[model samples]
Target: MASKKKKAPPPSPQSLGLPTGGVETHAHLDMEPLDAEVGAVLDRAVAAGVSRVGQVFLGPAAYKDGKAKFADRDDVFFILGIHPHDAESANGVNLDAIAQAFHADPLIKALGEIGLDFFRDWSPFEAQRIAFREQLSLARELDVPVVIHSRDAAEETLRTLDDMGFADRPVLWHCFGGDANLANEIVARGWLVSIPGTVTFPKNEAMRRAVAAMPLGAMVLETDCPFLTPIPYRGKTNEPAYLAFTAAEVAHIRDIEPAEVWHATARNAAGFFGLTLPSHT
Candidate 1:
């Protein structure tokens, strides 16, 4: 019988040279098997230098679930909104629920993971548009920043934001996979773009180029965890601890030191999310 192939060991945060107290700007700890191990997962993240996590609540249910799970954790902030894939289910009742939760929880920092997704079209296009518009209005009313999720609908997304007149508000393009031109446009518009684990993939040259062209000031780092796990750990479930790999890749692409990428992204995340960094960071 042939011997089984040995799995490569996972990278350590310290070995990767990540800076202390780096923030994970996007993750879904409220979802799946990871949710059951939230405490341990968070402890591991801290051990890996990811001291702050922006736990994204995709819908009203996720908002409630995340609130129950992390209400007392000061290091875990919340971003609550309706994902484009679930636009069909969004309505007055749930929208109200999200708004109420936002108002009730001071930890809720932004209104999103919200925008257009033409690729999946999991929800009707019209419904996604309507939901996106309404949520942009809500973000304006609440005076909070917005996190946008535009996949294969970047043009439409930008047009809608311009039309809705909320383009002036702070916007964060989460898991940005667009080209360098789009990245430049986002930076020109004064919006932030989050670099995800996809940047570590070999075939993601476009994303790499985008990261190269984007100014450090307009960038943030995220795992989009339990999803876009970086290379060397691609087959494994992603967690905040693996964020250093993404940061390392970003540093390599930008031709800068890993610590510079980590610290700059952390600062950008803090400013965008209104998070107060620990004194040491």
Candidate 2:
């Protein structure tokens, strides 16, 4: 009988050896197998050099129930908004709750992952549009930064942002999986883009090119976990710890030191959300 070959060790974010102070700008830890191990997950994040995480609550209801999970965590901030999938039932009541929550919680940094998502179409397009506009209006009125989620609806999303007078305002394009052209447009609008783990995928040459061409100051890194895990750990459940892989990959694409991407993206994220994160000497 032929001898079986030894199994390769699973990849880890530690291999990237990124310095501390990385930020995970997007994550859904309220859901999963992830929630079950969230404590251990966060410890690993710090160990892997990620010091901050933005916990995105899909809507008011989710925020109400999930915000407490990170109550004791100063390193974790909050982002609450109605996602396109939940737009059908979007109403003033929900918006009121979000507004109240934002006002009551000093940690609620931005109003997002809002915007269009024609790809999912889980809710009616008209409903999604209405909810998006409503939330944008609220963000504007409250004078908070906005984090947008546009998918297969970039054109309309841009048009809507322009219509809403978002140009030159503080806004972040979350989970940016676009080509160079789109990246340029976003930069032109004075919006920063959060590059996700998708940039590390072998087939996502467009995202890699986009990261290369983007102004490093306008780019941040995110895991967008429980999903979009980077290569070498692509199929595993993503967490804040995986953010280092994303930073390393961005540095590889840009031909710079991983620490450069790590520090710059962390700074970008902190400034965008007005966060005062811990510093590593």
Candidate 3:
């Protein structure tokens, strides 16, 4: 006889108790092996009260899968752009194709996962810059926000944004790892910053302080799932359902109630992504 497979335990009520109007602003569901289990994952997130998920549309493969998935849900929204690492995948016509996809799908809300990445030059740095600027221009034309990914290139990223006049539109520095001073500047300029579960890591004192002092309106919570799983779940594949841990940590750092953090961050995300918030009245 074949051995029985072990099933993952159901989410605990505490883990499932998301505050009203909670939203998951970033995650990569249906993007890879993760796609195989997305249904169960979303079922769990819904059970946990996560009302919205911002899916990302990257290169050709991601865009195709994203469109198919986008076809299935009223609750899920998407971002369309080439990722920095995949900058080489872009060409003049590919850029046109990406913008066309965004135009074709009103469900595609923003241009992003675009920016500079000097950490791994998987794609040439110049290609990354060109792709980044092209998307920024496209975003300006489309009147949509940009989801930025800056790694080992913060100054360059901000400088590029400045050059492109990104100040006129909303920009989210996703999974921000910058210090408080950078946070202050970014927040002062009215750009939003998203915090990931990495803030709860034992050594990120700077990130903790930044999260604690961040203005509620300028802050959003993201799991950056299958990557930055928070504290106790640190080594596992992150899911949107794990946002409760993230909210609890943010609440602990700010010394505020978790529900309050949930409410504010949800509102910030809904506003940033131009999604409708569930009516509190």
Best by TM-score: 2
lDDT of model number 1: 0.87
List the global CA lDDT of all models: 0.87, 0.90, 0.81
Per residue, candidate 3 scores C-alpha lDDT tens digits across 241-269 of 77777888889999988888888889888
Write the residue-wise lDDT of candidate 2 on 1-281 in tens digits. Answer: 99999999766888778888888999999989789887888989999998889999999889888887887777899998998888875798899988999999988999998999999868899999999999999999999999999999999999999999999999999999999999999999999999988888889988889899999999988889999988878888888898888888888888999999888888999899988767652
Which residue pairs clash within candidate 2? none
Better of 1 and 3 by TM-score: 1
Alpha-carbon error at 110 in model 2, in Å?
A: 0.4
- lDDT per residue (tens digit) for residues 241-260 in model 1: 89999988998988899888
Those runs of model 2 whose alpha carbons end farther than 4 Å from true positions after fitting are none
Q: State residue 48's C-alpha deviation in candidate 1, in Å.
A: 0.8
A best-first ranking of the candidates according to their TM-score comes to: 2, 1, 3
Please list the residue runs of candidate 3 whose C-alpha ends up more than 4 Å from where it truly belongs after superposition. Answer: 1-16
Q: What is the lDDT of residue 202 in candidate 3?
A: 72
lDDT of 1 at 18: 65
Task: Give the TM-score of each candidate.
Answer: 0.95, 0.98, 0.92
Candidate 1: how many backbone clashes? 0
